[model samples]
Target: MRLALAQLNPVVGDLRGNAERILAAARSASAEGATLLLTPELSLWGYPPRDLLLQPARLALQSAVLDGLVEQLDGLCSLLVGVALPCDDDRAPGLYNGIALVDQGGWRGVARKQLLPSYDVFDERRYFRPGDGPCLLTLEEGERLGLTICEDLWVEDALQRERLAGPDPIAALVEAKPDLLINLAASPFDPSKPALRRQLAGQAARRLNCPVVYLNQVGGNDELVFDGSSLVVAPDGSTLLELPACREAVQVWDSSGPQQATAPLSQTPCREELLLRALVLGVRDYAGKCGFQRALLGLSGGIDSALVAVIAAAALGPENISALLMPSPWSSSGSINDATALANRLNIKTHTLPIQGLMQGFDTSLTPALGQQPQGVTAENLQSRIRGTLLMAVANQQGQLLLTTGNKSELAVGYCTLYGDMNGGLAVIGDLYKTSVFALCDWIDSPEARNCREDLGLPQQGELVGEAIRRKPPSAELRPDQKDSDSLPDYSELDPLLKGLIQERTTPQALVAAGHDIPLVERVQRLLQRAEFKRRQAAPLLKVSPQAFGSGWRLPIAAGGLCSAGPD
Candidate 1:
């Protein structure tokens, strides 16, 4: 039997459109003589449809789409499509994430996801009802194929492992001796996730001595983006066909013989490449899915904005990106020149809107009420707000979306000006740190970025032509002669401290005690705790790490903690 695994990127809630995409893939696979075409979990309504499942009308609409799918794609191939179905004897008559085995023979089998993931980014316990029975359906050829949704395969509890782990998917499939062990998954992207998944599939296939085909969804859905790195592992545990993560690939597997390994686990790109690809896809999907062709941002001549500009150019075309250089009295000549050089090098449209007059007007009106110069943080924030206002104006007029350019480091410390640089529809690098941001930029500027630029034919050959953005010390440039290191410890010093205080899972007092410099640690720790409110208000960032704000890490809004050297 020839089976096809269709790794798709479907927009959430677009039932008709998603069905069309699925049908097209099925047709393409069947033309090549594939008998069965398996799709990722929840391909019709998209995975983790979240609260949309709560609405009966929405589920009914999805049900209508699923019914149409059963009619439309039957004769082409035996299709296994995932969708939300009303549960049998459910407590509230709610829905379950289910798969329908459909063919010209009509729908033959259904399998609800058994293990609903509740940790990390998944909250499936709030919605789905687990299936009680193990499904082993007989195909037209009188061969049985075991069916299981994503989380069901990974489930292992102490009690279950001890008592009934014998009915594991691979073990059960081996016992039943099915023609193929096909799974439907809606896996999200983590830097290390795909490797573990590939290893597990390869190991399981070898142990069961049967071919295993896994299908995963691709594309960004709100806060989570599914990277489709679908592949087939032969019965011998060798990878016959492999598709890289973050792209759409539909691969056919021959169940008759063993195949050679074309690529090993080592083919996965480096972290820099992984992150660059992720951001590019994130920006592309966010902009394209949101129906915006263009993006605008205030380029402050710093590495953060410059890196964001490069990503925007990669995501949207260089021509579709708009760069604005807003200078105030505090703006330096070096900054103005750097901003212009970077914009010109990128080939993006640029405009200069000096905020001197605007700042003056606001200052004059508020002088009497304040009776003092707008100095320090307030004054610096005013400049940022002015630039943000101008950028939003351009965005409104030109029908473009504003992209926020702050990195996680600054967001962690509340260094960014709220409602100013933070005013945008999406945060490109909000989940990345100041350090990782630089590394990604360097990779983009490397010879590799030139050779393997996106399919759009954007010229990355010159590769970040200007040296200023690369060499300049990172800074907000909100105040005259200001540098980030002056206010906080050097990134080399502060990053590890921040990581210990947050990322490394160390306690505040322990972090101070672990140390090289206690005062700096305390200062950094204090900023981290106080910055909670700021981080709370910030937009959702694409999380590259295991822990990022609003997802893995959740802290209290109130200042309530125990430590002499508190999360200061």
Candidate 2:
């Protein structure tokens, strides 16, 4: 059988649009003489449609959308489209995450997702009820096809510690002894997930003793970015073909033909390149879906803003990006020059809005009300607020989306000001640690990134983030000669500490035992706890890490049980 995989992006809740995407792909596949087409899971309603699945009207629309897809597939190739099937039993949850087979005139359910994940970013058990057994589809050519959803094939993988307790879907399918195995998925992007997926598919192929076709979704939906690295693996656990990552693509594989030599399956991109592509895709989709044509950010000439400017320029065209040099009285001349030079390199427009005047005006107006001039942290935050307000006014007047430039290290310990540097419609790098911010910049300047940068249409020659800006000490420029290290621990020491606490969920004693300083670990713990309120109000950050500060990190603002070093 000639099968085509439609690795396309889908907008959540846009049933008609999603169906149109599927139909368009089906027509192309049919033109190419493909007998069957496979789509990503939840292609009709999009992945993690979340609460949208709860609406009665949406369920009604889904039925109509399915009927339309049946009509559209008439006289064309057979299609396996992902959808949510309503439950016939009242005792079960209202829906079953399933795939429908649409041939010439009719469609029927081929397989329901057996494994419903409930850990990390997934909460499938809240809405979907597991299927009781395996599903096998028989094609007109008399070939048996074993169907599985995203998590159904993940049970045997030891890396996924949060496996469901239901019957092993892969084991059940193996018992049926199908000729070919297929998995439809909407797996989100993580730097290491693609390799892990390849391993899982190889294991499944070896167990089933048949070629496995894996199709994954590609796009950014809310906090998730799906990297559609679909693959076809031979029964001997060798990859026959692997699709591109972080983009939409369609390709065909002839099961009857000889194995084709393609790129090495085990090769993965450098961590820096993988992360950069994910961020670019996330920014483009978020801005485009939110209906913003242009993006603007306060360019402080620091590492964070420079990196964000680079990503924004790449995501939205450089012409569609604008930067504001909101220099305070404490801002250095080198800072302004560095920002301007970077902006020139990226071919983006820049506006110089010195906030010293606004700073003085605000101090004068607030002195009488408070009986004292705002000083220290208050004064520092005032400068940030002035800059944020100016950027917001410009963004509002010009109808551009504002991007915040705070990184994970600063955000973890309350180093960022709320409604100031933290003010923006989207936080592009809020999940990146300060150390990661510097490393990514270094990678961008290195020869390894030249081809990737050029492919993304970013400035290819020389350094995109100049040497001067990168080598300088990290500072906010809100106060005179203020260094980040003067207030917080050095990022080299702090990033791992934060990672242990936040990502690893390590207690203070455990971190201290792991070579972190006792006093520093305790202080960092207190700071992280105190900063929960600030992070609560910050912009929605793009989640790249396994444990991002957004939806996954759910800590209470008023909690007092801090991670302790010992019996205090």
Highest lDDT: give the candidate number.
2
Top TM-score prediction, candidate number: 2
Model 2 lDDT-worst window of ten: 259-268
Per-residue lDDT over 154-181 for candidate 1, one digit per residue giving the tens place of the 0 to 100 score: 5344212222222465555567676666
**TM-score versus the correct structure, for each prediction:** 0.92, 0.97
Per-residue lDDT of model 2, residues 1-568, tens digit only: 8999999999999999999999999999888999999999999889979889989999999888888888878767888999998899776467899999987778888899998988778888888998889889988889999999999988874756466788887788887888889999999887888888888898999899998899999888888889898999888878898888888988888888766544555456788998999999999999988899899998988999999999999999999999999887788999999999999999999989877778889989999998999988999989888888888899999999999999999999999998899999999999899999999999999999998999899978899999998999999977788898899988999999999989888878888778888889989999999999999999998888888988778899998867578645
- Residue 78, model 2, lDDT: 88
Q: Stretches of candidate 1 above 4 Å error?
A: 155-174, 177-179, 262-266, 454-456, 509-516, 562-568
Candidate 1 residue 287 Cα shift, in angstroms, is: 1.5
Look at candidate 2 and tell me the lDDT of residue 151: 91
